[model samples]
Target: MSAEKIDLLNFLQAHPPFDQLPQQALEQAASNMDVAYYKAGSQIVELGQLLDTWHVIRSGSVEVYRRSGELYNRLSEGGYFGEVSLLQNRPSRFPVIALEDCLIYLLPKAVFSELFDSYEYFSDVVEVEDRSRLRHSVSQREDANQLMTASVKVLLTPNVLSITETATAHQAAIKMSENGISCLLITDLQSQICGIVTNTDLRDRLLTPGLALDTPVNQIMSPRVFSVEHNQQVFEAMLLMLRHNVHHLPVLKQGSAIGIITLPDIIRYETQNSLFVVSSIFKAQTLDELVSLKADVRACFVRMVREDANSRMIGGAMAVIGRSFKQRLLELGEAQLGPAPVEYCFVAMGSMAREEQLIVTDQDNAFIFDDNYQPSLHGEYFAQLGKFVCDGLAACGYSYCTGEIMASNPKWRQPLKVWQQYFSQWIDQPTPEFLLNAAIFFDLQPVYGKSGLVKQLNQLIRYKAKANSRFLACMARNAILRTPPLGFFREFVMEKDGKQSNSINIKRRGTAPLVDMIRVHALAIGSKAHNSFERLDDIIESKLLPNGRAEDLRDALELISIVRIKYQAQDLELENEPDNNIEPEALSAFERKNLKDAFQIVSDAQKFLRFKYQPGRAS
Candidate 1:
């Protein structure tokens, strides 16, 4: 090959779709590739114009636009455009312009057609075009079959009614009749959610029992309340109701009930197989029963993967199952120990809180006792409760936190004031140890009990961490520790330990660093969102990062997460133990090539983190 063709071949081998092509095909492409340049702000392709070549950016940036002139996508070096038009042999569907002075490589229409027609990899890559993998992943989850795309708040009645748990059944029935509603949320004296009472409960526990109309509503109310977040999906609410076999479900936002949903509401929406798994979880009456249901959980996971659910949808569904396990465990715990002496919230931290949990994850949870809690008086009761839940979780496939972060650890089970002190100390002082603890503790959401305690703790971290420069600097420094798994020459960096040698722990190398850096940014921006994707939205809105960098980071995170999710799903499908470690050599050429690009994005984001925070160099 000539020197020019060699250079072109090297460039083609470094980018996607082309990188996956056979060596002979690549040489053919490089030999025929034509190069051209355009000045910054010059039009490369116009709307409705016929195109004979597929334009790929070899240098500089470009912007693709729709016919109506809305910004479609911003592309940097190695980003390709004009594939859609070339594929269809139609007019240029999206106009393209050079955002900066650009060097472009034109692949002839004949060669483009040959590669796309013969190679599935090329076809798939080109189909993404300006929409990119991020859009493709999201669209997969929001398709016609996925009910999780719509929010639960949409199904709620405009006006919801509530009655005190102390009120008589007659009073609740009268109110329900007057409002023409089927259910009423039962609240305690403090107006906190105590339970939910529905017409079914009245019919079964009151009318059919020949009980007096003046009986207390609590007598018939289901104390084990199953609720969904208003921000949660209609399908998720449906699943909760299915799991517990309850018709009335309370919708909560920020720990307070906002509305209620019923079975008919979800029937009008869509149904998924995952809901049936969740329903089965609540039906388990014993620890053995819960443990035996693990196979069904795996089945649900594999089914969703087969049905083409994206990482977000699968992760959200799995997180709900995990939380339901915790919820049911708590119910079992309460039943085993009877009523607790003091109120407390069982908080799930880390991946569970972020709603990105996969099948292979450890339990990271803590307890937040009420302010009035006295360890001297209530210590034993809480300890038993903690062990019951944690042990039950372990039995249900969630491994115990190796770091001992569970509530079973006495140090983690503390009163609200003590927990506040812990958060305050972690932020204000921020030693290496505290920063490590903060990483897990910072991303917490309550799974059961008085969740308001969790809300207060979250508010404390949001305001305090945002204002504390030293704390953020230390956090950024900690985040920079786990860099992406790519060597200086862009080769895969293999693990050196034990049986996993020569493999990469994707979580530790890819998702961890990305999530850690994003968390630092989210904290600095005072974003309360826990999931990395959600946090990126807040960061993007705040303009905390440079233009297009936020989206790049978001796309990078999503891609990396999807890779990890895919492997775990694969393991489950094969009936093997699910794991985070992945061998690059085991991946197909397409995946191996794209993984390197994703790792490079991680490296770039880490460099930005160091420069932005400056850590020790801040002075």
Candidate 2:
């Protein structure tokens, strides 16, 4: 082979379909490949054009548009196009344009057909829809870990044992013993599972406290029952158990208890280091003790990444761990400062609220006081409480919010009425400043205290923000301000002035922009969901975007988040401080290509957002 053909073969071997091909087939395909180039904004294949050669993007990017001129897809380096038209032996249905100056590999019709006819996997991939292809790529990344794929049903113990809430504690214990179970579900008179009592509960609530055996099981049981749907992933069940510090989770199917899963059940599937870290966090008594677990937190993060946990699972687990820290710190704070002066809700904002937190995150929190709260009287207590929580969070791995959006800032700490008014004002009159605040504050979830306070605030946001077109438009504008770090020619545009010069802050440019865009859609659709992936589900159901757009955004967010997470894990492995900034050279060939595709999706989503919410348009 000539040097050029050899390079082509190597490039093809690194990418999919071709990568799946046998070596002989791959070399033949590469040798027969003819090269073409297109200038930026130039059309490669017009709609209805007769197509023969299958075009693969060797470098640069292209935009594929439907017959109606709507964007169908974006293909970056290692991405291929023209297979659809060629396979059908028909005119091009989707037009292809160079998104940037491009290097294209043109596989002859004969070679392309031969490969497709001979290889089932290659044909299967090439023939799948774009969203399916993206999902396949994501699934491929996670396929190595059974925890990602295995359902909670697999871990459930047979014949879930239960006792009526009216049953005595002795009866519950006897039932558990008879069934060889550690826990028994407590059901109400309607036969609906209501609570759970474990051997530990039996020991602590009955044996240690010397409660009468005739006491109602309801009195001894944990009223707040945490559970999993039978079909949920095992990791989700693990997270629920870790988040709530529960030992047993009743696995329900269609509102009926089928079986139960325990901590030991999850441990059988994978390492329980994250669960242990959370357990330790809740067990820690002092700020110093909580601070000491920072290393454990990092180790947990690294382990999750190494284990092939997807971005959502890892993020949810980390957020649970983070909330544990806050919860433990609040317990300690109350010990020193006494009970709260008034009912208040400690709210986590941004990534934590979204359950998309990573190891390298800052604390974004606030307090919502009851409307009846008297600031003059209650102010000192909350101020101390806020300082205690924020300082403690900083002592742990979560640094203080750079913008001072923490509870420590009195601006963020406010009464429930004031919080509602704040949301109303931000929605009704969204200046650039308020829009910035909305981006962070809108994704709020209560971590502790009177959660009703936060609920009122969230209800106000969902009701007002969705109905206000001006606010949504302004938010859409703010969302696009930080564009993906892609230059005109589809190359990475790095940060030039920071200490981490020539690197990209993946969170800032990649995931954050995607989140910002998704948040706009979520607010526009009145979605109550906080997490980006869940919001996408709501958005998709609402049919707010063009077909496949929400899925594209989802794939983009997941890809970008995982890349950012993996980079942080790499940093931790090297014993260096983890940060969001990622050097382009540090990414593998596969990562760089997929990241470019993901970034392009973000850029496109931003454009659609701008078009969908024109500033002057009515709601």
Candidate 3:
């Protein structure tokens, strides 16, 4: 073989399908292959063009398009195309254009056919459409573990036992004992599930407390039920349990209870140390004990990234650990300062509320007190409680919110009715100042205490925000304020000042803007989802975006997030303080190219936001 042929064979051995071929077949392919090149922005194949050659990328990149001109896929080195046209013996259905200067390898139609027919594995792998393959790659990257693929129903115990809310503790205990179960669900007068009682509750709230057995089970049962749909993934159940520190999760089918799953059910599938961190958080009795586990938290994050856990899984797990710290601190606060003077809910905002938190985060939280609160009698107690919890969180590595959005902020800590009024004003009469608050506070979730306080506030926001066009427009205007870090020529526009010069603030320029854009759509559609990806689902289902746009947004978000996450993990491994600023020179060729693509997607989404909302009309 000539040296040129030898180089072709070596390249073939490195890429897939060709790599899977036998030595003789590989030699045959290399002998028959032809080379071609195209300049940037050159068309490789036009729609309806007859094609008899299979094209593969040896270098540079190309963009594939559907019949309607929608971007189908972007292919770089080692990426193959033109197989679909050759396989069907029809004119090209999808067009292709070089995205950059390209060197292409062209396999003769006969050779391509011979390989496809002879090798079953090569044929099977080649047959998958590009878009389907991209979606699969994204999902498979994120959900590689069994806990992600298996449904909660796989571990559910059928025919969950229940008793009426009015039932006596003795009766509930008898039912649990008779059925040989450790827990029972408490129902309402109409048999609707209301609360749950377990052996732990019985031991702590009743037996150990020396309460009469005849006391109503409702008084002893945990009223806030955290549950999962029957078809939800086991990992989701694990996240729910970890987030709220609940033990039992009732599996429901179409709003009706079908079975129940316990912590053991999830433990059998979980392999990461995130659950261990959360468990340790709850077990810690002091602020120092919780502070001691901060290293454990970083280790868990690093382990997850090393294990190839997706960005969503990593973010969700970290958020759960953060919430666990808050819950434990609240417990310690109550113990130290005596019980709160009034019913209050400690609510997390921003990334924590969205379950998109990471190792580097600031605490953004607030308190919602009952309406009957008296400032003189209850103010001192909550103020002290807020200081204790916020200080504890800071000690655990969640820095205090520089914006003073913490529960300790006097303005943020307010009565439930006051919170409701605040949302109403923010939605009905949005000002620039209120719009800034909306960006942060809109994604609120209850971390501890009366969760219903936050729920009621959420209900009010959802009802009013959807109908208030002006507010949505203002939000859209705010969303576009921070555009993705891209120059006019699509190069990364890095920060210009300080030690971070020539680097991109990934959170400020990438994920945060994407999240802010998603939030605008979520509010417009009245979506209750707190997470950006979940809100995308709602947006997709609502047909709010043009065809294939939502999927593009999702892919962009995932790529940007994983890159940011990997950067943070690397920082922790090096014993350096983690941050969001990313230097383009530090990234691999693939990362730099794909990040540019992702940033362009963000830019396009912002344009659509401006067009759809007419932000200029907000005033």
**Which clashing pairs does model 3 show?**
none
Alpha-carbon TM-score of each model against the true structure: 0.63, 0.61, 0.65
* Candidate 1 RMSD computed on C-alpha atoms after optimal superposition onto the true structure: 18.8
Candidate 3 lDDT, tens digit per residue, 1-619?
6899888989999987787688999999998889999999999999999998999899998988889886767788899998878988999988999988999999999999999999865775586334334443454343344455556766778968999988899999999999988899999988899999999999999999899999999999999898987657787888889899889999986578999999976774353477767888889988899999988888778867765567888889899889999999999999999988889999999998999999999999999999988888899899999999999999999999898998888898899888888888888878988898888999999999989999999999888989988999999999999989988888889999999999999999999999999999999999999999999999999999998899999989989999999999999989999999989999988789889989999999999999999999997
Point to the candidate with the largest lDDT.
3
Q: Write model 1 residue lDDT over 314-400, tens digit each, in one string.
A: 778889999999999888888888998888999999998998888899999988999999989999999998999899899889999
lDDT of 2 by residue, 1-619 (tens): 6788789888988988777687889888977888998998999999899987999999888888878775666678889888877888999988999978899999899889999898875775575434333443454242245565556765778777778999999998888888788998888998888889999999999999999999999998999988787667787888888898998898875478888889987885454367777888888888998898888888778877765577998899899899989888989999999998888888898899999999989999998988878989989998998999999899897898899999999998898888888888888878777888899999999999889888888888988988888888888888888999999999999999969999999988999889988999999989999999999999999998999999899889988999999989989989999899999998876678778989999999988988999744532
User: What is the lDDT for 118 in model 2?
Assistant: 89
Q: Among all windows of ten consecutive residues in candidate 2, which has the lowest summed lDDT? A: 134-143
- In angstroms, how far off is 602's CA in candidate 3? 2.0
In model 1, pairs of residues that clash are 243-279
Give the winner by TM-score. Answer: 3
Better of 2 and 3 by TM-score: 3
